[model samples]
Every structure is written in structure tokens, then in C-alpha cells.
Target: MSSTCVSPALPDSKTATTDPLPDIAASAPTHASTLDWVGMEDISLPLYLAGQPVLARASAGVSLDAAGARGIHMSRLYGALRELESRELDAARLSGVLEAFLASHEGLSSVAEVRLAGALPLERPALVSEAAGWKRYPFRIAARSEAGAVALELEIEVGYSSTCPCSAALARQAIQEQFDRDFSQSAVDAATVREWLGRAEGIVATPHSQRSEATVTVGLDPLVPTLPLPTLIDRVERALGTALQTAVKRVDEKAFALANGRNLMFCEDAVRRLDDALNADYAPQGYRVHVRHRESLHAHDAVARVERRAPDNR
Candidate 1:
């Protein structure tokens, strides 16, 4: 006993300090009131969608429904988000993330939601030529869970060409007048007229065509096997008939022009077309269609919105 002296800071065998790390989040709130949702945003993550890898901006949130809990576990929401990186970004897979978020905050949360936003480069071919190129479409997927029910939403941006129907008809009227004026003085032979039709002056006017956009958002039906993202894109492009071309040669440009000439639509027409197509498709439980036609003749864009509701299979 005379050889050793212990520091006062050292604990005796009977008394000892346990864990010292403080968990402020687990403490009770000073003022008691529940919050709707709280978590993180603009998180970076990778997604494998439709067999393609894409970088996405991710966000996750969970409701603070428990009035007694000070705060929900934010770290748990971030941890659950990691699951998206390992699986194909789809309805079934993303639903797991939503479930995990609520499960991790079991006592504090009853609702959870996550959003993944990114640009998907979709390869499309020229309308009339063999050339092809890539177009980046802004895409988003949202998953939400309340109580025990889960819902998934898929959103995509599609660019295409829209020519005015009235403009085309007016241009045709002017051409007919031009034909009458030109042939009034000259002999009307089939060869001469055909040769004139091939010339620049023969086709004096062309209806204006401008780039248009369709923002299609659909709620997926649980019965669908996989995410039909590719098919959704294909359906929109096919419905519009004048999808924005990637590569453009002289031949391709001509083909695109032909396509626009064939598929003339106003903003009203676009929403109706997309509305019908989505309603007819079996993969979606419901859908919302929004289209904007950047008018060539006017400075403002013409817009339309349509919603179609289907049976809630969920």
C-alpha cells in the first residue's frame, strides 16, 4: 500500500462510469408537437434502371408522427437509401427503401417517402436515316409509404416536334394560289408543272415547327412484373410520331420534316393523345400528362394537363 497511489479520476471497482456518448435525438423535445416530415435532400446515389447505369440526386424523409419522440432517426433514413444503389430502380425495389425508413424509425415515424431524380440518356435513331444519337431525358421516381401501403411513381420528360395544323393548311392554300398565279401565263404541261414543283419557288411556304416537351408521370400498378420505363418512352414517342431526332444528316433532316408534316398537333391534341395512350396501357394504375408546345409563331408556349385514373390495385 505504501508503494502505490491511484489517481482520483480512476474509478473504484464498486463504482464505474459506463457509456459517455450522448444521444440528443433520443431525448424528449422541450416543446411537444409532431412534425409531418424531416430528413435529408440532394443526396447523391447511383441507380441501375432499365439495364442502364445513371447518377441520381436522391432524397429521403420520414414523418415525425410520434408526439413523444424528440426526433426521428435521420441517419436511419440515409442508411435505408443505400439499398437503392444495390438494386434495379423500380417499384418493387424502391418500395423496400420506403419500408426500411419507417421500420428504422419504428416508434417515431408512420410515413416515409423518397425521391430519385436524374438524367437518363436515351438513344434514338434518325427518322429517315440510319444515323442514331443520344438524348438526355430528365427522369424521376418517387416512392411513398403510409401505415403499411406503398405506392410508386415514375416520371419522364420527352422531347418531340409539333407542327401547327392551321399553319399547314394555310401554307397549302398559299401554294394553291401560287400554282394558279404561276400557271396562268405559262402552258400547263404535266412535265413543266412537275419540274416547277421540284424547284424552290414551287414550294414557297412551310409551316413552322418547334421543339415540344411532354412530362408524363404515372403511378405503377403492382401487378406489372418490372419497370416498363423503356416501353413508356417508346409509347410516348410512338404516339407523338415526331420524336426529337438525335443524329441529323441531310436525309435525316428530310425525314424529320416529313414526320412533322404528318404529325401536326396543338397543345390540346397532345395531352389527349398521351392521355388515351396511358389509359389504354395496363402497366399504370393512373397517370398525369402535361405537354407544352413551344410555339414557333408565338413567344409563349401553349400548355395542357390531363389526368386519367384507373383501378387502385395497391
Candidate 2:
């Protein structure tokens, strides 16, 4: 009875509520947008090249913009490249890669770019012997898409021998005269002299043989796709006929010397040969060819660019 009387003294108005107001979170601040490009660089991977799988590394770049965001989704750019990992890096496959990159971002109108630099094996006949070995060279491929159009670029570095026509003729004439005067039955000089004359014998009649490099770029039409890399390489080598090679044997070396003699050329000849090869192969594709030769003779580099004119509709 005492406990009941004490409880009854506490009125309902004096009692406190068991529950408090629910916690509420403030809204996040919105940021202004800007144009941006993001991606991963120098990623190492393995790729199939020249019928063999070899290690390849790549540098990837992507760009996109949003209406209200400051930058693009950087992680997405890397993710796009990751998805392309195991896929072929050919012209067709590259289109898919660019498509995915562009699709990864919502507001981006232009697709990003991917550039891969790696080693490629070139099977070359031994210089002295008929046996063959592989030579590794630096290779690069770049691709990008803009306004629903895609462009692919391929770069390959190859070493080849260039014999001078002018020097060769002069050397031959000098050797003939020396043999006629001496009558010593020694038509050619010692090994050292022969080597020296071989290099010096050219059309230009210079002491030093010209060491040259060729860089060619062709603009491809989307409608006519596919890049015939191997074919192009073969055509180029055929045009020059003196491709530099490693692992040479005596027989192969002799053969190479003959080839060099057969295809002696100047810097201008080399550039023209490249142009002819490209024009013949890409005639239907409608591509413009650009050729540059780093000449050893002149201080300045020699460059030649040619574009096929548009077909007449009439």
C-alpha cells in the first residue's frame, strides 16, 4: 500500500519522453564542372606479336567532361584499358577499345587515345650464312576517336643497308685503272682496302657511306579499314633490297653485299622507293604517304610527302 501511494504522486506531465529527435545529415556541396582527361601510363603486359607472345608495355590516356563536375572519372579510364588486356591490339580491336573508353563516361563526345610502345621481333637472314635469327625493334601504335571517326597509327623501326650508286661506279673505275697499271695479278687491294672501298664506292663519290633512316606515315580511311603491317614491311624491304640484319654468316654476308650492289640508291632514291611502295599498295585505300630520310651525307634531313589526288566524279 505504501509503494502504490508513492507512485501515484508522480504525474504524467512530469514524465520525460523515452525517444529523442532522429539524427539528420546535411546535403553535400555541388562542384562546378570542367574538361579533363585521365588515364594510366607505362603499364606492362604481354602481347602476341609476329606469331609469338611477347611482353609489351603501354601508355594510356583518356579524356571526358561533365556539365557540373570539375573533371572526368579517372579510374574509369584505367578500367577501360584493363578490360582491353588480353584482347588483340589490331585496328579492328582498337575500335572496340575506343568505343568502350568513350562509353565509360557519360558526357564525353570525343574518345580518348592509347599508345603502346614495345619490342617486336623481325626474323632476318643471317648476314654470313643462310640461317635466320630474330632481331628485336621498338614499335609503337596509337589510336584515337573523334566525332565517331577513329584513327590508327603504327610505327616500326627497321635497320637496313644503303649503298651509294655514285660511289660504287667511281670505285669500280678506280679499281680497273689500278689493276691495269700494276699488272701484279692482284685485281683488288687487301681486305682493309676492299672494305674501305666497298663502303666508299657510291654514286656521290664520298669517303663515308651515308647511314639513313626512313620514317613513313599514312593516313587511313575509315571506310577502308585494316592495316597490313607485314605486307608493308615486305614491300619496303623489297624496295630497298638491303635490309640490315643481325647474325650474319659468310654466305649471307656475300648475298647481302650483292643485294646492296644491285639496289644502290641515294637518299632521294630511298624516299621515292618508299613512296612507290605505299602508293601501289594503298592506291584503293586512298591514303597519303609521308617519307623522311635522315641523311648521313647532308647536315639536314631529307623529307618527301605525297598524297593521291581525289578521283574525278565525272
Candidate 3:
């Protein structure tokens, strides 16, 4: 054989322009898709918190791995998020950013995700005082893309008071028995018994108390985008009726105590109430939700979760 021999079919003009189907295949080549997780993290940015322009920061994370890509286009992930920072990041703005992330990595058809978390302040309206200020709440915002679908989740932490119903009833019974015994003695008066029992150790015995918290996740409709964080917080606080306050006066403390007694709830009670509230507010419009309560009595925590089916996936 000669050292430089040409192939016989090298100049076959008959089959020069093979089938056009290979170029039109709407999928990646076999060896370009195999990354596990990719995206951004701890990227600081600003946010308009609770209707106020606040300099808030967040950790933005994303992943772009398809069925067979070796790795994601790392540069493209940053570029996509840069577009988000250039534009304001509202709920609507965040959804658009997710779309941009998917479009940036063409072969990444399966794994696409974004996460943002920051502390947001809530503007309080002075429930029991004259001076009005803001309350800061920790919020976590996350988004994910898979199979042409995207979702957003919000986690909010709120503080509230909870009184035990069982304790309250027992206290009332003890007070009644004291009055009856004082009447039988004919020397000690009912008022004296009340004064003695009103001491700290006497009146408030074994009162089960907890600072309740609620965590909710919602799937947003791209067509109609809005962050429901403020609305959700208000609903949760009202339902529980004993939220902890940053600024308080004597009058405020009294009102808060009254509220706690009126809305006494166990951990189970709080979860059920929150589940009902979320279903009524968000389920009909296509949103998923979950709630958790941190117990004060037991060492371990109590959690509750609920979800509404999406329109297409139902």
C-alpha cells in the first residue's frame, strides 16, 4: 500500500449532502450532557422589601445539567443572573430570570434551579401604641425548573405567643375552690384568697407556651406573577393572634396577653389553622403550601405540610 493513498469514496458527488435530519435533531449530541449541580451562590443584591426600598442581600444559586452534558456553561449562569441584578428582582422579575437560565444552557433540559434568601422587613402599623416602626423577618426565596415547568418557594419566620387551654381551665378551677374554702372558714375573705393566688407562682402554673412559626411554599403562575410574602405574613399573624412584638408598651403587653388567652392553641392546633388559611387563600388559584410549628414544651419540633395540585399536572 502507498504511504498516502486516497479513499475511493472521497469524491462521491452522488451522496455529497447526506440527509438533513442530523442537523435538525432538537437534542444535544451524546457526549455533551453530564453535570450534577451548577449555578450561583452568595451573590449580594438589593430588594424592595415589603413595599420599601431596602438594601437586602441574598445567596443566588442555580443548576444547569441536562441528561448527558459533561458540564454546564458556567459563564452563562453568571450572565443570566447578571441580567436579573440589572433589573429589579420582584416575583415577576424572578420568573423571567429562571427562563433566561434555561435558555442560556441549550442542552440543559432537566435540571435548572435558582435560590435566593434574605431578611425582609415588615412595616408594622402600631397595633397598640402610637409610634409605628418596622419588624424584620427572615425570608428565603427559591425557584426551580424541570421539564418545562418552574416553581417558586418562600420561607418566612414569624414569632407569636401560645397559651395552653388546659392550664387556663385548671387555673380557673383552683381559683373557684379557693373562694369556696375562704367562704367556709368565715375568717379569710375571697378577696384575700384572690390576692394571695395572684402571686407569680400561684396563678401561672404549668402554663404551656410556645413561640409559633410558619413556613410556606407557593408555586407561581408565570402568566400572573406577584410575591405574596407580605400578604401571607399578615394572614398567619392574624390567625395566630399572639405574634411577638419588637416594640411594646405596658398597654401593648396587656393587649398581647389578652390575645394569647383568646387564641390559645397547641402545636397541632396551629398547623391545622395555618393549613386552613392557606387553602382558602391560595389553593383555588393554583399554589402549594407547607407549615411547621416549633414547639416550646418538647425538645423536638412539630411540623405540618400541605400542597395544592397544579392545573396541568392534576
Candidate 4:
């Protein structure tokens, strides 16, 4: 029997939609492979560091331990960063954030890491004047949690003046030769020497000095209650003995010049000074020191580096 058959009327497409949204990352990957690190970087955020509010760039990541899983929950890692904004950054706080990352990932991750970078501003008083100005110290903090342990590291940059020892010696010799030539035929007297010293001809040459920078990275002890950023910076600057100044008056400039003259050093001297200071005073778990002297006498920069790790860590 030939009969026309009509299917029951179907629901409209708009009203019939009932499927859930797609989550591609929740599905198994086409190629199963464990990734070491996956997440976000250079994320701008506001956080408290060294007890001061700072705008920092953050990086959050976790290891993709599950081979079959397409990816870790990146949003969870990003969401965990909110803790940094609510509290002052420290080893304990960072460790907590990492723990949150692992908890959120559950079986998908075994390791988590967070990094923050920003400039710390401190108001510095002039060497011999009432003037004070802000000095910005660039710093980075990196923390990682794995196997129920947390590791923290801090890196900072300090600027100073470095006068070349060899240049100072050569300049002294030049001045001595000039003095000998001037006084060989004349009678020696305090007034005569003072007057000669006041003249430009007396000091024939000046030692070459240049602005230098020290970049120090140290592994923080887990027991440390707070990040020792200001203390570490003070130590580095004191070791160099000629920190760069802000809001300089004539007296401050003269004082700085005197400091540079007293602390004549090459890149090697600068690095060794920092190494000795850190070893004797701070005694961190591990540390790396790098000094760069931007040379005024030559086009090339002089640099020195030193690295040390505690015996147990090594």
C-alpha cells in the first residue's frame, strides 16, 4: 500500500538546543605526553612586596603530569594568584599559593611555580644634605613547590660607582711626574704646594670611573620569616661602598667622589667584595653574584661572576 507518511513536527532549532558547551582541554589529547610547565607569564598584577604596594609582573605555571590529559587547568593557576594581591609576598605566602595550584590540579599536576618581578622604591637621604629622593631597585622573586617542598629565590640589582685601580695608579704617577717637574727648580714649601695643588697644572690627570651594576641572586632559607630584600640591598651597597645617589647636592657629589676615590676597584674587586659579604653576613643556601663595570676608558664592559651553593644542596 503506497501511503504518504509525515514525521511528527520537530522542535525549533533555537528552543531544542540542550547540549553542554565544549571543553576541549578536558578531553584526552591526540598525542599523550607529559609537559614540564604550562600556564601564563608576564601577567600584570598589583601585589604587596617588602610591606609596600607594588605593581608586579607575575608568572604562574604547573607541570602537566597526566600524560593523557590535554592540559592542566590554567585558569586555576591564574586564580591562585589572587592570594598574592591580598597579602604581603613572602616565602610562606608563595608556598601557600603553590599549594593551591596543586590542589586545584589534583591528579593533573605534581609541581607548581610562581614568579614575581617589580621595582622596589626606597627614599634615600643625601650623603651630606637634607635632600631625599626615591631610588628604585629592580627585583625578582621565584618560588616553586614540588614533592611537598618549597624553594624560594630572590634576585636584585644595585647600582654603584667603580673607579679603576689601575687607572688611579696611572693617574697618581702622572700627577707625581708633574709635581717633580714643577718643584725640581723651586723651593718646597706648604704654601707653594697648596697653590700648585689649587692650579689645574698640578693634577695632570684624573682616574677613570664609571657607573657599575651588581646583580645578586640568592636562595632563601625556608625558615626565613620574611623576604630580606632591603637588608640584602643594604649589604650589597655597603660592600661596594659607593652606591649611586639621588637628589645630589654639591656636597653629596663631593662625598660621592671621595667615596669612589677611597674604594678603587675593578669588576673582580666588586664581585669578590659582594661574595665575601654574602658569605660572612647572609650565609644563604646558595647565591650568585655578577658585577658589571661600564667602562669609560674602553668600549667594552668589564664583568665578573661568582656562584656558590650550600654543601647539602650541591
Candidate 5:
């Protein structure tokens, strides 16, 4: 009688199975809490910026204002980013994306932000040679929107050469000593001096030069029509003319050396020049410039920073 009590055969673990998927995100959270930002980062998306294709590391996020809501529709953000995959990111387009981010979760979020960062490849000509090459400049763009208000930020890193002022002065004094010692008792002739100057011993000592970086951040006023990324980069490079070079021939190297000598700058000089450049532009509401000279002589880098106070500020 006990053996006859077997029930109908049940499904085995080995059997193929498919069932309705769980929807946990829609379920109420165990502890309801508001989050400042909830979304994605380091998302890879292709972008065409300034007519060039860029593989951008894009991030999108939103504030969870509604504490009662279980969670935001994070997948919606991923889908919205697809709309920008093939587009050139501009201030207007970024604002639109932020708008969509908030609109996707009207009750759960009141603010949205998106950031896209990538290196932009630019064709560069040699200092004195006809050959040209490509160089990459890192660029970052961020836009935030809340309750129909929008703020945008643009950042780029510009590299240049900085020569030590004290080192240059010392180098000049050493050269004078070499000149006095070489011809102090001997007679001086134009050809003889030219031959000596062409020698490394004639130069005596060379000033220490370092590769320097300027991290420039600009806050755009709402009235600004375009992103003006190129313009910003141009300003920095123009202000600091001893920019990094790509192609290198003897002529190009000599030209670069000439440029570094002509634009002789310390870390403070570099920062002051960048500050002047930013002030000369009216499109930005505020700006922050950080110049760091990777000291060739010192283990630590020399740094200087400058910022402009925004009228509406932050």
C-alpha cells in the first residue's frame, strides 16, 4: 500500500526548462534610499567628433531623487547612448541626452549627466621639415542637466617644453668661462670662434628642459553656441609655442631647440601664459588651468594652478 502511493512523475533536474524571468528591479527595495547618482561608466561608444572618428569612454548617470522607487531603469540609459554612437557630440546634443536620461525616469530622477572622453588625433607638421605626422590630444566633455538647467564642461591636456631659467643663466655663464679660457691668452678670429662655437665644448653647458603638461578645464556659458574644443586647444598651443613635436629630422630638432630657447618658461611662466589665454577668451564662464613641469633635474614635478571665479559660479 505504501509503494502504491507514488504521485505523478515530477520534472527531473536534467530536463530542459524555461520559465518567466524574474523582475527584481521592479520590486520594492528592502531599504529605500536616495542616491546622488546611479548609472553607468567606462562604456565604450564610437563617436565622430570634429569630423574624426573617436572611440569614446562615455559615462551616463542620474540622481535617484525618489527614495520610494525600487531602482532606476539602468538599461534605458544604455539604450539611449546608442543614439549618440554615430553622432558628433556637441553641447546641444549632450543636453538632449541628459534630457532623455531624466525623462526616462521622470518620477525617480531630477538630474542627469553624461561624460565622454577620448584622445583626438591631429595631424602635425614638423618644426622645420616637410614631413608631418599625427599626435593625440586627450579631450573630455561633460554635460549636466537638472530641471531644464544645463551646464557644460570641456577639458583637454596640452603638452609643451619648459626650459629652466636658472639653468639657462648658468649655462650662459659657463659658456663665457669657456670662451675666456680658450682664447684668454690666444688671439680670437671670426672663423676660429665659429669653429669653437660649433663644437659641444663651445656651448659649454645646456639648460635642462622637461616635457610639461597643462590640464585646462573650461566651464561653458549657456550662451556659447559651439563646443569650441579646437579653439580651446589652439589657444593653449599658441600661448605655449614650444608644443610637442612629432616628426624629427636634424633640421626639425634644431628648430625645436630654437623654439624651446625662444619660449623659455618655468612652471610659473607656463601657468601665467595659460591663464592669460583663458582670460582672453569670452566663451567660458570660468576656467581652471593646471600646469605641471616634469622637472628633468628634480625628482618631483613643479606645478602651478589658476582658476577664474564664475559670476553665477558653480
Candidate 6:
């Protein structure tokens, strides 16, 4: 009687179940309400832009139109983003990704969107030297698929040097006053003035210049085949006329200084330059330009913004 007790056998994990695992998202919500957007953000991924690989942070989402469903399948949205790594990014590829997003969440979503943010590396040559270096321009690509149509947008940030117009005028006035004090009593001679101009005392006051940035966003026309990031960058840099240099010898530095002097611009001037450039050639559906000058003379930054819409778009 004392030896009669025995333990029962446990079920093997391998044979525990042949049935599917529970999916909570397939069930109804406790309180059903549709969400405007539902999905993932800050998903790290590798993206190819113009055949160059870049590390990107992606946000993928879809409108949650299914009021009864607990949630859309977030993994499906992430899976669709894999397309970004496979090929050079363009409007068509971006639209394809959005299409995949909607396909994966069909019947539960009508609108899908994807955003990619990364730095694009471009080789930049020195202004007056044979040397070259890589410059990373931060950019963002946003695309949405709604009502069976796709809309694409591109954004880029370009850095440049900006010399304040008012500051330049003020500095020139100060230098003129100083020159009058120095040469008022003496008869001015060309050779003597040349010697004086070479000295630091001759150019006593200098215009305030600062590292400035222009952020441009444009709605891409569907007919545009590729992502025109490099072209847009070139256009913006050319318009601004004093793009930040990567590698510089003394000659290049001097050339850069000369360029800045010749291209003195306030934030307003920078915005208008960008506006004219974008409107003239790269006619997007619409565009917005925002310029910021990080002031060396003041603690606060100077900023300006301009926006335009195509007549047809309006």
C-alpha cells in the first residue's frame, strides 16, 4: 500500500499542438474604433539610392479602416520595406512599395504611406585644387498611395556660407570711415593705397558670415522616372553660389572666401535664389524652400521660408 503511488507522464512539446497559434490582431477590439494611421516608425534599414547604399530610418503605416480588427499586421508593412534594399530608389519603386503595403493589408486599409530618411554621399571637388572629398547631404523621401493614385515628395538639406547683406554694408561703411581717418591728410596715391589695402588695418571691419542651410521640399511629378536628388542638390548649390566645401587647400579656401564675398546673401536672398532655380527648371507639382542662417553675430538664428504651387496643382 505504501509503494502504490506513481507519477503521470507529461505531454511532449513536439506533439503539443498541430493547431495554429492564437492571433490577437484577428480578434475584435474591446472597444472598436478606426484609427487614422497604424504602423511602425524608426525602423532601421539599408537603402540603395542611385546605386549607392545608405543607412535609412523608415516609417511605414496604413490607415486603419477596419473598426473591428484589433490591429493591422505590422510585420507585413515591414516586409514590404524590404523592396527598398533591393534596387536603386525611384518614384516607381517607391510607389511599388506602397502598393505592396496596401496589398498586404487589403480590405483593412485604403491608404498606405512610407517615409525614408538618410544621408546621400556625393564626391565634391575642391574649388581650386585637384583634391576631392565626400559630402553627405541629408534627405527624405515620402510616398503615399491613396485612391489608386500615388504621390511622391522629396526633401533635401544643403549647407552653405551666407554673408549678411546689411552686415556687409555696415562693414564697408566702417572701413570707409577708417580709410578717411588714415588718408584724409595725405594725397591718395595708387601704389600707396595698394600697399595699405594689403595690410589688416586697411580692412579693419569684416562682414559677419555664418554657416547656413537650405531645406527644400518638392512634390515630384509622376512622370519623373528617377529620384532627382543629385540634380536637385546641384541646382540648390548653384543657386546659393556658396556651397559648403569639403576639402580645401589654401587656394581653395581663398577661392571660397572670394565666392562668399561675391555671393553675399541674407536669408531672404537665399530663399528667392532657391525659388527661382526650382521654378525655372525642375518644375515640380509644388515646392517649399526654407533657409536658416546660424548667426555668428547673434545667439539666435535667422530663417526664411517660401512656398509655391503650380497653377495646375492649385
Query: RMSD of each candidate?
Result: 4.8, 11.2, 10.8, 5.7, 4.8, 2.9
lDDT of 5 by residue, 1-314 (tens): 35556688878868759696887766788888988998999999998877789999999999988877778898999888888878676777777778789889888899898989999888888877797998888999888888789988889998899999899999999999999998999898899999999999899799999999999999887546677877788889999989998878999998888898899898889999988878866434788899999999999999999888676664
The TM-scores of all predictions, comma-separated, are 0.89, 0.70, 0.74, 0.92, 0.90, 0.93
Q: Which pairs clash inside model 5?
A: none
Q: Write the per-residue lDDT of candidate 2 for residues 139-200, one digit (tens) a residue.
A: 67777887787777666655567776777777777766654555455565587455644553
Error of 6 at 146 (Å): 0.5
Predicted structure 3: lDDT: 0.65
Poorly placed runs, candidate 3 (over 4 Å): 1-33, 53-69, 86-88, 108-111, 187-206, 285-314
| lDDT (Cα, tens digit) per residue for candidate 6, span 1-314 | 36776789878988876678899899999879998899999999898886789999999999999898889999999888998786788888788889899998888999999999999999999998998999999999899889998888899999999998889999999989989999999898899999988889999989999999999999987658889999999999999999999888999999999999999998999999999999965564889999999999999999999889866776
Poorest stretch of ten by lDDT in candidate 2: 22-31
Give candidate 2 regions above 4 Å deviation: 1-38, 127-129, 183-211, 220-227, 283-314
Q: Which ten residues in a row are the worst by lDDT in model 3?
A: 20-29
Candidate 4: tens digits of C-alpha lDDT, residues 216-286: 99988765799999999999999999999989899999999999999999999999999999996445488
Ranking by TM-score: 6, 4, 5, 1, 3, 2
Better of 1 and 6 by TM-score: 6
Model 3: how far residue 24 lies from native, Å = 27
Models sorted by lDDT, best on top? 4, 6, 5, 1, 3, 2
lDDT of 1 by residue, 160-228 (tens): 999999999999888888898998876787899899889889888888888999999998764357877
Candidate 4 lands at a TM-score of: 0.92
Q: Give the winner by TM-score.
A: 6
Q: What does candidate 2 score on TM?
A: 0.70
